[model samples]
Target: MTDVRSDDRPTESLRDRIATELGRARDRSVRLTEAVDDDDLVRQHSPIMSPLVWDLAHIGNQEELWLLRDVGGRTPVRQDIDELYDAFKHPRKDRPALPLLGPTEARRYVGTVRDKVFDLLDGVRFEGRRLVTDGFAFGMIAQHEQQHDETMLATHQLRAGPPVLSAPPPPPSVRPVGAEVLVPAGRFTMGTSTDPWALDNERPGHPVDLPAYVIDAAPVTNAAYLAFVDDGGYADPRWWSGPGWQHRSSAGLTAPMHWRRDGTGWGCTRFGRYAPLVPDEPVVHVGYHEAEAYAAWAGKRLPTEAEWEKAARWDPVSGRSRRYPWGDEDPTPEHANLGQRHLAPAPVGAYPAGASPLGVHQLIGDVWEWTASPFLGYPGFAAFPYREYSEVFFGSDYRVLRGGSFGTDPVACRGTFRNWDLPIRRQIFSGFRCARDARPDETA
Candidate 1:
């Protein structure tokens, strides 16, 4: 993990910044709640999950615990704040009974504590001693709030809460997009050789071959896959693989993880915000089971990692390997909808300039595509110098996934970087495009 040094202004005096962040967190809480109703706020899919209102309280409680009491050495706020919001004890259930202040009072609590902590920090003159407690407290608070941000998205995707939309995502642009065309059968190196950010399983840069095949021009989108769902895709067992069938049955997945059908067209629900679903944006949060079922229903299959890379990026227009689909010149805004701007996947085909040689619309960003490959070490693959890296799950439960998502740091993202997860998992940032053995005419 990168160790971030405390900023030069670590002295407790910067009450202003803390106050700003506290208010910002409260503002975010209000925005997240704007679309959700009391009934919806109380709903949850899993037993352990907390309510949005509870989440807001915990966010403040965490801030107070770390920055106020721990670092600033101030008398603790109402002692109940710890008992109410303590994640280690409370786990997931939302208890409105935790003595949480009303929205107005919660905002005040956060703001006041922030001001006091900052005021304390400004006066402390350390003999250059690392303020480990203070530094960790700040970082921990940041992480705590970030977890809520994710929970906000997860709650929306699950549709456990009523429909909500705080911000309307920008409309999809008027850009014509193309799909991943065919690549000829051939052998090529797939997976990362260097520690170009190798996940635990992508080590050993395995060489794999692809028979002639066609891949989807891009990821399966809300519009395209909706046809399968409309045709009773979920109810049909024949369309799912053995394991996929079991998963679908248990999870009771009926639609793309992030989509909520409003009226006729679909809109994505995340962070309690709903926007018109991009007809061409990759359907996200659907795990391997959903991806497989979609492929079977559509009479296509996911590409093997080699096949996916071969068609989408490997056969680059230039012979040299570039980190991204377009070329090696890192990424700019137009190149892909990375960064945290929308804080969610862009509509597919938004990044035409970033298309791969095969005309794949979003070869790099928007959603991390699931491939047919299993997570495994490569031939002659050894774990990197970092011991916990690749050796843990050689032939374990994880499956291979590729292409980073919209929220990913584009600098760390690349065509070859690999990620993995258990098969049953689904969330808003994960999804797969389809690929299949090609008819002779379709092969490159």
Candidate 2:
């Protein structure tokens, strides 16, 4: 198979690759938007998330700012609406009241920007400016669109209606029953140094020394979480921290979000329909606090951010890190679940082909696995383009989530990619797997 990662490609091939990626990203966004009506596009599903129309236009505005203005040296096309699309200036709750563009106007504005961008690409030289040198600006904008595409899919799940989005289920997984895998103590590179399109948070790869630890071969399953719930894990304050206990009490969260007791058994809603909770599938829509409580109840803890990366990418024999768990190869349907290919997670112990060298499974895709670490930058971290993308949220306030979910696009997901959210949020596609420290006398 040809390696698209090679840097020796012809200039024309490079441009074509960029255009293909941008088109795929845009198509995915459009498909997600078309699933809902104009009323759904304008309605705010949650105060925390913008209406679908806002996301549609914001994707275009960012593309225009980075690709057309910054890289192509083109003048602004819609200067008056910049502030309306400025994410930092306007919160999601206030977006619905703004003098926003209607769905038709939003489509026309984005269409115009894209046409101008392609025209600029036709005659552009790839070697002079920093932003355009290696097609960095184009790659960044493509990634930005794909990220918002995932967010828009989340809005569709949050909106109340019959299921408008559909895809065939992932192929059944046939891996053996999983067990904890032990990672030996050693120094390993924790982030990226060579990925050209990597965001600032994953730069200046640093070496981290970690003691031996054991992590689950697959993410904690819904069946396992049910065991915790049956044992009064939520009602007992012993398994929760002070703040976590307070939040759970106030919210009255008995099970994961969108889950309820049906007669005698449990059922959960997905996209608008309720079905029996699949026992073998990895749990989703869990908050950091709930994950922590479950870990405590299981007599284990969430792995630190460094530990999770080490398990996913480090190869003990090669003594180096890889681009992904299955090596540098890009994701495929046979390897993992992603790109909104399915509405839910595959059964735990699925995707053996995507397992880490140490035999950890589903580390790349399933759901965003919550780590014990806070959202902080590595050594020598520097913000690129802007600080709002990552630097502003670096603190103990937001917890880190590693590994992408089913809604994530491959263009935006990688082994080193870092995602963070408030510890109390349960609206996202998030889940957890427990880890425990290895005994000093034990060996891998």
Candidate 3:
């Protein structure tokens, strides 16, 4: 692992990038967990989420397992607690019952592990092994931590106390986006074979031919979704699928989660604070069932995963796919509202620079858009390093969601990144835009 090639410029650059990303992820984790009191960190905010303290230590344990132990060939720092943090071994609902480390202990443990990781980073080889090749292991660990950071942010939203998080509001809409944009009929690459840090599910980039379709220029907004509520969408059975209606009835879901009737208008509770709904911001915290009902009510349907990808990544002029809506470049503040830059979704058409080549706006961030597809691997899929990451989750039980949300980190949020969950989950920062088959004239 210590062997270094003669020409070290590329290796040095990779190391520097890995270090920076790892540090950024760790800083966010610290901030999220530190904002709340120790009791709150240890308490289970929701049965669907682990205690904040559990997540803090689990982040460290994963780094140790993948980076220090697997890549660097170092001894385990806390081998005794390996099973305690094993996510599969204990579900979120049962995590609080385990003998979890105190916040202080968890912090110290992660800090020590990080020190060892940096030491290993100073001289580790970035070749000769798939795990360490192109610094994939480091990148994987960083992405894992960022994913947890987003989960912790969701837990903050589920808390019953006062708001504990804050960020500047996302930029206001500067350009007027049409209701929808027409994606011309053609084939476009759906996934990635070249993204160095892409996980197993998004591998082996493949061509997906799709019919001409129209998708929302931006995600469905609170104002538009409110129309559905005002029309008594919840009481109507025609708008919802049989299973969707069943879940809706059982769960008592009316407006989006955290929303309540505030006189004639609606109010939403964000991070424990109640306020009037922002009419123009994309509707969030809705599940697949709710998004599906809204689309059906509006005489549209949810876009297939392929259609969503085509709208976001396909460059009509170049006949190729770009990494994001804007281009092959990484996201900037001007592009999208990501990495918790704002506490909520930006207003529709807020990021004009982030529009796709076909003029579809906000395709990369704000809220994770639900799709009309299940979580299945591509045609030539192969499990890499481990199957638990993506392979195990493949089936009809989980639905696919594309596009990252405002809380999502850039490292984990790309055009091809795949997120999945049960159709009834409302605690996640998810939303959807409507799509429909293009008219005969529009297809031409």
Candidate 4:
């Protein structure tokens, strides 16, 4: 993961991280289109998640706009951008469709922009200007699009049919679990917390005191969740939110998305892998509504962002914040189940070293955990222009999720980071863990 430029300055790391992020974006982009149909390409569900076809061009333009046009000060990849899939403004659903990039042309567009991003990143330095903002822009978009790639993998199947992801199911992991403990609430910081590698909204860390509570020693898993299903949990409307009950009643969600029974056991089919769902494997691909339903069923709840941060806090001085639970050291086969040849989710509880201090296993990778929070800025938050990132979605319908999944690059998950999605979106690389009241008296 060497940045082409080897500068001695601190920005060297920024350069390196960007290099990694951009490279990952390109890697996932291929997956986005591979399993999709040409006709279904422009079918967009939401603005944040646009038509698969239009989304490709939008992503390419995004990189050029921020990294090249704004930050690097280059002539845009294309002039008259509005005529050619501009993401800066929303696509009016009623507007007559203009001629758009075909799959071939759009692929070229992304390729052209990606090459420029890496080239420009090699030599640039964000000195007096807002380096942090620029860094987040690059990191967030790369991470953001990767999430989209996960969606395309499944949704494209609905549109046409998805390719069987050749990647095998990840190997099961084994490691010692971290300690489980309750956090005593004091005047602790809430809202977005910043590490050197944080999204813009996560910056300017501020404080929000919380109450003392106990969090899960490990994320909730397929094993534990099976017990819920085995108990006829879905049949009981009492366990579901009103919205969840409506959706489940209408859609008939008897089990987690992609889950199927294998004899008396359960397993999931993801990106073409049909392995037995390890009981300890973290439950994945469930939407916010689904996660909430499970929590209510279990008489527990999803952690608030503040509660999540309290459980997964890092020591800035120790430099452990960079990603791997132990530190910035590259992930080994032992510390976490990431960057492996398998290229898909492993069994949960496999990587004990990756656990949070409270013994929350697999907090950093394996799967993106759904939280009860929504995607919003901290108190007194302000978004940058080219404002689509946070502003468009603020106070909206999106629900927040955390951690990164197996499809995610190792660097993408950060403690206290936030990811948002709709309540019913089971197509992405998403999952859930459980939390509950600290006191036995408070337990539901």
> Per-residue alpha-carbon lDDT of model 1 for 80-174, expressed as tens digits?
66776666565565464455566556656766766676676555444342333234334335534644654664555566444454333533755
Global lDDT scores for all candidate models: 0.66, 0.89, 0.94, 0.67
Clashes by residue pair, model 2? none
lDDT of 3 by residue, 1-444 (tens): 357577987888899999999999999999999899999999998999999999999999999999999999998999998999999999999999999999999999999999999999998999999999999999999999999999999999998887789888889989889998999998999899999999989998999999899999989999999999999999999999999999999988888998999898899999878899999999999999999999999999999999999999999888999999999899999999899988999998789999999999988879999999999999999999799999999999999999999999999989999999999998999999999999999965
Sliding window of 10 residues with minimal summed lDDT for model 2: 1-10
Alpha carbon deviation, residue 164, candidate 1 (Å): 11
Q: Which prediction has the highest TM-score against the true structure?
A: 3
Error of model 2, residue 359, in angstroms = 0.4
Each model's TM-score, in the order given? Answer: 0.64, 0.97, 0.98, 0.81
- When sorted by lDDT, best at the front, the candidate numbers are 3, 2, 4, 1
Off by over 4 Å in 1: 1-171, 195-200, 258-268, 316-318, 385-388
Per-residue lDDT tens digits for candidate 2, residues 216-277, read: 88899999999999899999999998989999999998999989999988989988989999
Off by over 4 Å in 3: 1-6
What does the lDDT come to for candidate 3? 0.94
TM-score of model 1 (CA atoms): 0.64
Model 2, residue 370: C-alpha shift (Å): 0.5
Instruction: Indicate the residue-level lDDT of 245 in model 2.
Output: 98
lDDT of 4 by residue, 28-105 (tens): 777667655666566654333556776677678777777778778898877555455654444535212656677788
